[model samples]
Target: MPESFHKPVRRPSSMFDTIFGGHDPADTARVAHSTAHALLSRVREDPEAEVVERLVAFTAEHGIDTIASLWSQAPARSLPGALWRIYLLQLMVHEDANTSSIIYERGRHELASADPIVAGAPTPAGPDEMVALADAILRGVFDGDFAVALNRAASFSRVEASGATHLADDYELTEPERSTALTTKALRLSTFAADLDAAAAHWRAGTLT
Candidate 1:
């Protein structure tokens, strides 16, 4: 196991308790801690090949919804929690990829071309395509630099946000409030990209939370 994963870590209460009150946070934490450690250790052995293989196999065998159930309630600072966040971001994009593609197509024309580290791969055109790209990017976290994957996601977010802005204003009956909301979304995603940069640095330093 990575030294960081092995160190003492705080266990936080489940965020989903209010909605899903039956599950016990303590039991959930215990399972998550072990599962996260095992998976992290496996990835460490051969990050490039093993990480993707293990994740793919695990999900294929056990199902993503099963994993996501636990992930939804995991504490944010824990390893499982971080993994959950990463997975959730990808899932959101993938689940609605077609809609996202349409929006991306509309705004991408006005924006500067994405940087290689940002959106190096081809823009996804549908749910299946986006899921493939999302998987690749997530796989890249262990196969390559985690920061680059995060930056790419951030870039993806920015592009979508820009599209939303355009969509909000495309009509003759443009809604200033809606446009402003989209602008806010763009700014927030930009900050998330920066945070991902810091997270990458932390990961390198063995201090990621």
Candidate 2:
């Protein structure tokens, strides 16, 4: 066969395959990844960003204190970047805290693992889902769901502990600057689940060595 005539093989798309490419979709790792994406999407999004409600109503709801206050002019490290870090970390906590959830985030890192906020890369929050979440929060707030917004705000407050201090009017993480690599504090289980679960699922499927 001519070298130019070779055709590429088509691969099947499973939840794992789509989320963690080259891995078998049936593995637990993928399950974790899927769950992480789904759960985080809910909590991070403004409408469903109920980090506490889900954690409390669901399971293992800790670290709700870490979230930074979005409405506060108290001076955060930076603006949008700070928001991203807090939410991303919360997602990790959510994945890890789940016992039945196969998601694992050890040695492995999630999106906030390496801080490249300056690259201005688009985040899940910037997407339509988050937009909707935010919209829902706004609508709900007017509809007398202030308590709901407050709860979501509470769940991610611990993220502020990640260090988003204000230099001037804008937000900034004064202590540990966000870069390609960030030195995080004692990590929460919710912050490390999805990645670990994805790895385990891959191993379970026997796709990875």
Q: Judging by TM-score against the true structure, name the best candidate.
A: 1
Off by over 4 Å in 2: 1-126, 156-177, 180-209
Q: What lDDT tens digits, residue by residue, belong to model 1 across residues 93-138? A: 5445676566666656656766323654365445565556667767
lDDT for 99 (candidate 2): 16
Determine which window of 10 residues in candidate 2 has minimal summed lDDT: 99-108
> What TM-scores do the predictions have?
0.61, 0.21
Please tell me which predicted candidate would have the highest lDDT against the true structure: 1
Report the lDDT tens digits of candidate 2 across residue range 20-61.
232443453344344444543454464443544444322123
Provide the lDDT at 77 for model 2. Answer: 25
Give lDDT per model, in order: 0.57, 0.29
